[model samples]
Target: MAEGGTTLEFTPTWVVAVVCSVIVIISLAVERLLHFAGKYLKKKDQKPLFEALQKIKEELMLLGFISLLLTVFQERINKICISENWLRNFMPCKKPSDDKDEGTTAHFQTFFSPPVLPATVGRRLLSEDSSAPTYCSIKGKVPLLSTTALHHLHIFIFVLAVVHVTFCALTILFGSIKIRQWKHWEDSAAQKNYNAEDVLQKKFTHVRDHDFIRNRFHGFGKSVAVLGWGHSFFKQFFGSVTKSDYITLRLGFVMTHCRGNPKFNFHKYMMRALEADFKKVVGISWYLWLFVVIFLLLNVAGWHTYFWIAFIPFTLLLAVGTKLEHIITQLAQEVAEKHVAVEGDLVVQPSDEHFWFNRPKLILFLIHIILFQNSFELAFFFWILVQYGFDSCIMGQVRYIIPRLVIGAFVQFLCSYSTLPLYAIVTQMGSSFKKAIFDQHIQEGLVGWARQAKKNKGLRKAANGNSAGSPPGAAAVQMTKVREEDALLRSQAKGTEIVTDQRSNSSS
Candidate 1:
């Protein structure tokens, strides 16, 4: 060992490589085992099992990838730490230059300053111990991590991976349970021989009685009150007034007016419209928020070594985007419900085509602009991540990367609110949407409306051909009539079955 440097045992490169490889192999083996276990455990409801196993595999794969990167860049990372004078006390055989030492101190001071101050204060204070060896006092080559440290690191990572997998499995399991309950409820209602109107009335009663948002916030407020800052007031406020109450009040007129409308099943429509949204938006948001929490914990624990701090903007954008999307969707659904109530039916009106065609040009222009911005931002963020590794993002002379990222995310948010609207409008114009809407209308006793729309579509096509100097022949008109009769007959048969089922239940 050099002068002033203490002799230290270093983990060999081969040993590090072998350890990393073993970790990766073990992770892969665990993933495979989980796959088989999931298959054996839930052969019928394989979706939830598959989802849990997929998440576990992703977490383990990330761990394995990180371990591989650490092993591959071991020497490079050590050199960087030495040059930056990081972990100097831990690597006493490596000495940083005097100027670099001063720079390092300044760097830490800046790093520990406000915004990050609370998080790093303990580390800074620990570094200031007088008995700690000076940076320049160390001189020889020193491993940034010893064998024991490496083992501890691996164990920590493994534990975290296990915890993450467990959470993922639990979340999926709960979601699956909810799905199963919904299915069971639907089956039970069918077996009870409840007609559509009866089912709708029951659902409407439940919706009217339940204050979902209020109850949720009430519990949350109680949890906050336990923190003891007079948050009982918060709990009381949530208990008194819920957000769902506002929605109920706003739609009260529509609900009352449409209750007696046999042409429209407003309650059934509301339940169907919101059920999928609740599952998709709320479920996805729950998972994302949990991921964000886990990521923040890892950052605070220094597990990512400051590299993943750059991902904060993107992660936050994703979480906020999902939440905003959910809110906007709910608002749109409410507006649509009011419109349907005022119109007194769920029929696709002839005026709808004119309304869409005459939509403000500015709105269309804005849609394109928003879509472009979203696509560009997503593409740019991904490109940066792929092109510039974590070191480059955090420390490797990349100027203004973080600021640019922040700007991009801010711009994305400014335009992201239009995403759902644009998708809705575009899909509304699609054939699939038309088919689904018409089918739904038919089911809701609006078969005449669908028949008229189909007839109008055929007429428009025939008129187009006639305008091109190809007049429709008698045979073509007859064929169109035949097609219409066939569709109407099929719809009537479906309606007959529903009536027969209801009559049989009444008789029994």
Candidate 2:
């Protein structure tokens, strides 16, 4: 056993921090130095400086991969867990017992309870029980992972990965070389902007019938396809329907097959609708997907604490994507403008040709990115609360955290990835459901308040000396109207008297 093997330590955390910091510092320094050298070498050939930077980039990538391997497998390397029985003695007991000195549930509670660090640390060391038989060998206490079958399995997997990566690199190299050698390729080949349009169109378009049905065998459609088959097999139970019916149709059918239960599957429906809306209205810009993968990987690795650190990479990707998208869009517009300019009257709108949708994709893309990013942070916080127990924190409640997190995740998935059909369903359900969910009195009060607001607005306008005929002060400006009415009345009376005189003269 090593002399300092059982010492209290937080070495693993410190080592990871130091290694990462050193790697980052070295990489940045090299990149800056190369960039400065490139500026100086403008008079000289620029090829060497560019090559050096490229080599540095590749080296940095290898260094990062090695650092990651070390961080992940550090525990496997150290025999500390096996050698340190002193640390395990303080860990939570597997079960409760009657003995006071022996560790129990009570001991776990006492150790992890409120103000834990103060209460648990710096306890006087107790002597080991001499009456118990001691095991001299380490094998019984610590399982040897080197001899285990799992170690061989890990080695085999990594070997296969190395082969796969090497093959991919060779394929890319040969493909690039061949492309460069092709004669007049740039002049004869279809415009690069043409491919950009195809990409945007495919992203924005709904999945076609053939793709949707065929996709059932893929991981995504397994549940949906199975449900569709069950619905077809038991169509009579659900109620007899024509072959054309949407929900009961099988996997090969043109219609969308219903997957979840109709009553409780509002969230699923919402998600599908939301996805469709997102695709059509604000197509994904491609680069956001890369960041999403990065986020998921970090979360799985339990490195979610540094999730914010991803913002640096994400922002860079976003800026680059935006610039690329802008260039592609401008190129398309320029092509259109050139054709129109030849016609002498045709006008070309860049925006109309640039994006597939009326709204910008960036807005929706950012929204989803933000939501995905926050989910990891929230999941980590909940995990901590669950692992440490409720009494661990001053404001922690007795409720289970895991179940809450699961429900939260379910809701978050529905909210972010799908449209909320429940909102529309509730809206269509009308005033009764609204009254049940919200108070009828509150609704009435809101209505009354709205009416009063209109009245107040009119009064305010009148007080401000507005003389528009429709305003509240219109009655105050009716003196001329009243005078005109009186004059007309007197004229009618005079005409009646003249008609009477004419009738008497005719009778005589």
Candidate 3:
């Protein structure tokens, strides 16, 4: 702060980001340890550790709220830097110059003619005579920021992003191929033809079948859910909502909801569902959490360029993973509940309260797309801005270029804040369309399969119609007994008394 050409007054955001990031990092580490410990604990029948794992997961997910803020603000950081540059450029006009020549008027004209941005302003503040620099960076101003600069920045960042995406896309393709090869090496495996829709269907199917591997796969969800919840809790607690009042209101609502329904089971079901979902996505894994922390570490460790781009991937990966997890979990739960109902469990019937709120997990996936697409793109531009300073390409150009930078930053926010919500809505609606397509197939397939199974069972019963399981003559007697029993049950339900003369006399 002291050495920097211009010292910016500490913004509340700085305190929030640093403090929250550190807490999130600690939470992530603890989550990782808990997960690793739980894996071994569950195997070895260590119940206490298993329970602790569950508690940790709950907290971690609750904290993932910070991650959302982190995502929101990381993009804005470059703006702050740029703004400082803006301030520095304007500040030098106030400082009086001692080495005044008759051409001091010429010098003043030269400065005003060149730019009104930080690159030019910064050079004046830090360089003294433009020889060498002492600090990590210098403040500079150029010409007022403009349209050409904005468009140019956009084009430059977009090209870099296109390259980054291309690489990741190639990596995904290569990774998929490797997976196929690995599967082929297994017992009796053969190459299967795949359609894109079918492949997507299968991916969703894996999510659908998540519970089949729940004991193994659930850790991932539990991890994210807890982090998300915890992040939210702290944000509300320390920063905005005034903690104790919030808690009181939360509990009051919970108590009020539980007031009439003497049946706590319904309430329990809703709470459990919320916990499972929230924790699972945000809490159940530490990979992306670790990634974000590690990426920031690189920046703090002196790789200034890493900070801007890294946030994109970290945000994308978390969002995508969270969406996939939530959707699959919900679908899987639905499937399980369907089977449970078929087996005649009254308790498994859908609660009326739940029906109103039970949105499909596909919303999660949609959210990730919204988050990563814009955030990732922004990361690219931010890196470019950082590069603009480091590479010395914007000094003389700064006077011409600073206006564009400011405008672009504002545009970034406007585009993101609006586009993200719109994307979420459209994608979620699209997922609904996809679900309708899949559900039609699933309904037909299951009905047909069930019919065939029933038919096969009937055929087997007929084949053994007189087997020792029934006995030849005894089958008729058994049928007669069954008919009599049905009649008796009907009569009892109707409250009718059969008045046989002998039975009547005995009763009299």
lDDT for each candidate structure: 0.37, 0.33, 0.35
**Whose TM-score is greatest here?**
1
| Top-lDDT candidate index | 1
Give each model's clash number: 0, 3, 65
C-alpha lDDT of residue 403 in model 1: 59
Q: List ranges where model 3 is wrong by over 4 Å.
A: 1-158, 164-168, 171-316, 326-508
Worst 10 residues of 2 by lDDT: 246-255
Q: What is the lDDT of residue 165 in candidate 1?
A: 40
lDDT of 1 by residue, 1-508 (tens): 2221222244467877898999999968976898787787456543433444555556667777868876676445434323333443322111224334322222222211111123223332211322344433254334344322343344445554454344323333343333233333333323454333543454323221244322322222445534322332233212222234323322332233332322232222323332222222212224443643454334321133233444443444333333323332333333343342332212121112222244423233333333333333334344324423233222223444555556555534332332332222222221122222122333445556467757766865665556545555854665577567767767876775566345433422
Model 2 ranges with Cα > 4 A deviation = 1-4, 7-359, 385-387, 398-407, 420-508
lDDT of 1 at 259: 29
Could you give candidate 3's per-residue lDDT for residues 289-403 as a string of tens digits? 3543453333221123332443453444334334423332333244444443221111111112221134545444433233333334445445545634333321223443344
User: Could you give me the TM-score of model 1 versus the true structure?
Assistant: 0.33
Which runs of model 1 end up more than 4 angstroms from their true locations? 1-32, 81-159, 174-188, 191-508
Arrange candidates, best lDDT first. Answer: 1, 3, 2
Ranking by TM-score: 1, 3, 2
TM-score, cand. 2 vs. native: 0.20
